[model samples]
Target: MSRALLTALLLFQILAAAATDTTSTRQPDLIKKGWNLGPIPVVAFDSDLGFEYGAVINFFNYGNGSTYPEYRHSIFMEASRYTKGSGQYRIIYDSKFVLEGIRIMADLQYLPTLAAEFYGFNGSESRYNKQWIRPGNKDYHSELFYKMNKDILRAGLDLQGHFENPKFGWIAGTSFQRYNVGPLKMNKLNAEPSPYDESDVLYNKYVKWGIIKEWEKRGGAHITLKGALIYDTRDNEPNPMRGTWADALIYYVSPNLNEKGKGHAKLALSIRKYFTIVPNDLSFAFRAMTQNTIAGTCPFYMLSQIVTVSPRRSFFEGLGGAYSLRGIMRNRVVADGFALANAEFRYKFWRLHLLRQNFYCAITAFGDVGLITQKTKLDLAKVPISEYNSYFSNTAQRPHYSVGIGGKLVMNQNFVISGDIGKALDNQDGNMGVYIGVNFLF
Candidate 1:
């Protein structure tokens, strides 16, 4: 079926199921041994990346009531395209008890981004010009002038054990990533009234100034080996009500940050806690994380992202998107070492038994903050400060703050359709962000 038809069908299914739903006060029995299928349309938009449209189909096997919420085996397959050419084609497999004593997870994905956002270095020290992104403005360069284009292919396997302990475990994983990048492809974007060479845009200035390099400007590949120690006690992995999840992840990269660079390493730490405020209804959740490059050099193309427990969205990167500081501009905070924290209140307002499945609706209020703890190596003095100030950025650099509210529709406590609206504390972070995505941020 065509994407449009599939999306319409997905909406019909949800609406038809809800219309036929029965209100329920009593808890339903845990899922009986059986197979279940769920398929949903994936839709989202970024002003720079255009609208994202796709579908994710999930298949699950639940063996008895032994682990109702936790499945015996799960498979997820997705093939989606974006209007802007930034999208994903992926497949993932996960199992808790299919193996004798361990949990196994594997994923293969190809993500191509047409207009990847790229502002200059130094976090808030890098000026943000609203006019650059606002087409038709007299000062407008190109709507995508501040963006870039890239293609990435990633594949990995992960294993975690110590099931008997439940709260503590050791995990190991390995992955290979390939990236192809360059200045934004504006001819494809139709951002200019007349065709222009990339030489005219300002990202070329970063290249000329040595902020970005010449060799890896086209992108490269690397193999990453990672091992981690974890402490997890959450009751449910999807949307936990209580318990703590803490982990320290370390990475060793071969062929280094770029194809020709020397091997280096990075480290990250995270702790998340969930609290039950009222039975079956309200709860509080919080997470804190720190990430840094410890040994060797990393390419500018790869330094912005840190470790994350939850899966990331296709078109976003770094600290200020829906997956991070919701109301702030995406990638607003990228540095050598960074710190981030998030707090949220989740309230489940209604429940129903629909289409032979359980469904619930919820609302959330949240706050997020991030800071650049260490600066990326740069000769700031050589780069004239007055030129950067020509943009609207205020000189003072501080923690980025944002507050937001969101809504969710969850089915069988696993699949979630989420929408959030957030406001930034700084106008430079952009006025606000509206995002539609999957899963809880933690």
Candidate 2:
């Protein structure tokens, strides 16, 4: 059977299971105590990254059921790889019990991508030609024309402490990250040699044109120190039905470990609100955020990352992609800074007991829009007259928008199985995207 048909069938099965013995009276959520474990096989597909395989395991400690849907301690571990030369391996630990009156979060990750997307700087300003990679087109180049190899080693620690009001908090964190970037590894992909010259690829062309600096072309290592002031009234961290959460964060990247006096400082602001439209069964949620470079210079390799006080995923590099703008191409809006918003309506149609655990099914309809707020400075003087149009659009950047639908299966209201299918409204942002993963994208 085709993947779509298989997915539909599985969804149907889940809905049927949850819909059994449906009733008007709401069932009370079963309080979870002690330690609960959830293990999910990582079987997923991404249009850009191809099929993925591996596993993700989550352990939650409720510590006497006082928090119900919230856990006192949580541990998340995943080991997954894609068929198209990408891999993610990580471990994360979070707990309120680690220190008195404080919450602690720590993570370590290694991500390797043999063909990371590189579509130049700034959204829309950087032209994307579908025909160039189309097999039968006259301008056909290699299929991997807009790709490069990149690997990241990252480790971070964050601490949060509440004020006297408890709703207000302070956050501080430090992280060490290293990026290794270069040309795509054709040998690793086991593909036949390309007929086109090396410069036919955008990365190679950019290097030759001086758009990507030689000192930072291969990537570098840096230490980042960040702090934030936050106000949170959310009832739950995983999925909040009603409340508002906002934070203002500032982070400074120390001078590049490999290059002297090369670094930058940035400011990020995020606000999220949730409204319960129909009590526990339906809700409306929205998040608005912006991140901007406030000082110094930001290298090209670091342009794609979206800094957050607490990262929800292993890869958070995008104004597009699953974590940000669902349907748009991954990292398609790279720039010095950007602004984005997400609005969604979530309706829980079914809730039931499965395998002695409380399970609920929800469907979401969401729209995402974003644009480059601070453009990356590019020196186009090096561009040849003949190739200027192909490399640059010379157009103003505008908001890229997409709309999509998603489904979720929440186990004990903590562990979530989620999927979304989004379509970009503009052809410049590509077509559509299908994502299957964990947690709500907040």
Candidate 3:
């Protein structure tokens, strides 16, 4: 057996032995009451972001333990930084008790990345040459060729209220976001002199060719108003074992701060369903979603942003990477509209109670696929005929596929530590990726 599987088996045996007295009876889960806190040090590594260090703390109020695993209020705080000049500081508050029969969620976040992925628009139409970044290759370019620098400051508030039927609800919210985007800082990225240091990067080339408009090249600020209709019947919020949750959202971006004439409206639809194949021990879950520009033009910088009823992570920019299509390159499929689907089988192989908290470990097998449905309009006339092939493939976009396996360790059914490894079926999407973070992909 592989070392990872062996290690997992050993861990299962150890935990089973530790809970020997409660295994047969399957002792009742401990009921938590009042205020509780779950904090974990953020120590991780990403190929693009470098080593990350910081902390994440979740504060939950269970009130009288009437809801057991469900908390009456939750506050999440995170402050972390990656070695390669990327950092995130965020605070989120969620509560149903804030208003009678209404749920409120709010968040404030600041994210800065020195190297944000920026592949050209539309999937497959933009060729991905791995040789460009290989140091010894004849076609080698700077490793940061496909990257740009970007920082975002965002704040939002959302409220959800049920109709006569509790399963149906309405959501309304507004958010303000400011983005600062530019070419990568090569001086900061390289400690030693290199041949490609002075080479023009993709972002600069796009700006020069007018593919990226000058007005939004440096980024801008905007306010978005959002409304959604939701139908939900999930048994649990963190990792549902049964039921379905679906939502249709419409959001309008107000005119940009720098260009009052620029604005757009978009629609996002998502549906997630969970099936209990073996009660609480084994389950299958799937999510289908599509986001499309309904009216008006979308800025190039904003094309990668995704809209959801409730934001789960600090950053949600992709049709790829951990948040969307696992194992594929991050933000590989940027377009005006896209459709995605993900399916996974989960098995809770072991359960135990320790440190006065309930714990369980699960293994998951999953597959993800997505494609651009509405292509972003690009003006190719400005491109020189001699260099057109380097940037455009003139081919139809197709679905990008990735398959992966993951494991999760859950504490009190609310705090989850998840790790996934995925491989892309097409080389253009990337070879593989390993992601470690909190919560499920949904």
Candidate 4:
């Protein structure tokens, strides 16, 4: 009977059932049932350079399941200093219900004060040691300028089960986080200076499980299976102006890369093929993925993924606002190399309305290629593609190639907002991107 008093009695029965269901029913207009489920408004403005411009607002609400059972809401706001004064105010809530089949969910997040002082860059002040590589963790240069004041609380729970005729799906979850590092700087080696205990606060708990499989027929071939599992305790999840968001770009400029590894067991596999000249918005889905890191270097207090080009950066690996890869700068796709494979080709066009909503817009044409495998195998005819481009001429390489054209809108149908404009035939430099949250990239 105590879990913060049952989450304050289920948030007081959802604000007393949203005030008696807003005076007797009638609030459901979920965008005419395409289901964006109403209550989402966002605004933003940026200039980037000492963080000069800023504005933000995000509000959302979701509820409706077989007649009033699900619920969700979100709120956010921010302001900045040359895009780095780092301000934030947030709130989130989620709910779900199911009885016999076992599927229940609950989530809550709150950030009362999450500030990032950013310390003026070059002339020193940011001081986030180990050079800062946060933006997707790949590039680095430092003069010490770091400031971060934190306040965060998180909550979570999820469960699922599936078994429909020879096919299967599974999901399991657990999460809890609380960290408050109000004033920082810690290191025990290299110049030493530790001891930061002012209720320095850091708590985390995690559990995860995942699996998925598939089959196909109507048009061609298809297959899939997924996986995940994690546990944590190794604090260091700071990223305001970039400096710790996994895939550490070879330890932010070769601190001898792959630091004697850590602890994280990961394994992933995939296979896909769909060839249909024109059926249901044209088709051609071909993918192949192979992930590995069988437990090592990964517990920096969780949340560090952001290794792009895989299901398109899957979950937030780096908190670099915007869905990512927009101009080749965000987690800049790192790793000294270890298993990566990609091949993409997509074309879908329907409705066109770049802005002024009404279902944003649509237009897509894509082509992507990737390859990075060398952990224990490399004899590409005696490694000499000009010494493998002079050892990657300082990062960013692969079979890499891109052709672009992108846009999508369907703030409904599971949600979506996409943008793309790729062109990287070995740095011909052409990447323009914009993505407003999820729905599909997978």
Provide the TM-score for each candidate, comma-separated. Answer: 0.90, 0.96, 0.94, 0.24
Top candidate, metric TM-score: 2
- Flag the better candidate by TM-score, 2 or 3: 2
Clashes of each: 0, 0, 0, 21
lDDT of 3 at 391: 79
lDDT of 1 at 297: 71
Q: Clashing pairs in model 2?
A: none
Q: Write the per-residue lDDT of candidate 2 for residues 257-345, one digit (tens) a residue.
A: 97887579999999999999998889999999999999998888888999886545523898788899988999999999999999999
**1 or 2, which is superior by TM-score?**
2
Give lDDT tens digits, candidate 4, residues 1-442: 1332343345335444434223123233233211234323232221111222234333334444333112233333333223333333333332223355434444454443223222211111112223232233333322112333434454544454444521243445444445343322323111112233322211100011000001100011111112332121111110011111112111111111223322334454444444545543444444444444443333222222332212112234221123322332222332323333333344444322222222322355655443434231112343345533422233333443445555444432223434444554543222433333233344
Q: Which runs in model 4 stand beyond 4 Å of their true positions? A: 1-159, 162-265, 268-291, 295-324, 329-377, 385-391, 394-414, 419-431, 434-442
Location of the lowest summed lDDT over 10 successive residues in candidate 3: 1-10
After best superposition, candidate 2 residue 214: deviation in angstroms?
Answer: 1.4
Per-residue alpha-carbon lDDT of candidate 1 for residues 55-122, written as tens digits (9 for 90 to 100): 77888788775788877887888888767568878988888676777788888989888877677665
Give me the runs in candidate 1 sitting further than 4 Å from their true place: 1-24, 29-32, 46-48, 194-199, 256-260, 309-316, 380-388, 391-396
State, as a TM-score between 0 and 1, how close model 2 is to the true structure.
Answer: 0.96
Error of 2 at 442 (Å): 1.0
Local accuracy by lDDT, each model: 0.74, 0.85, 0.85, 0.31
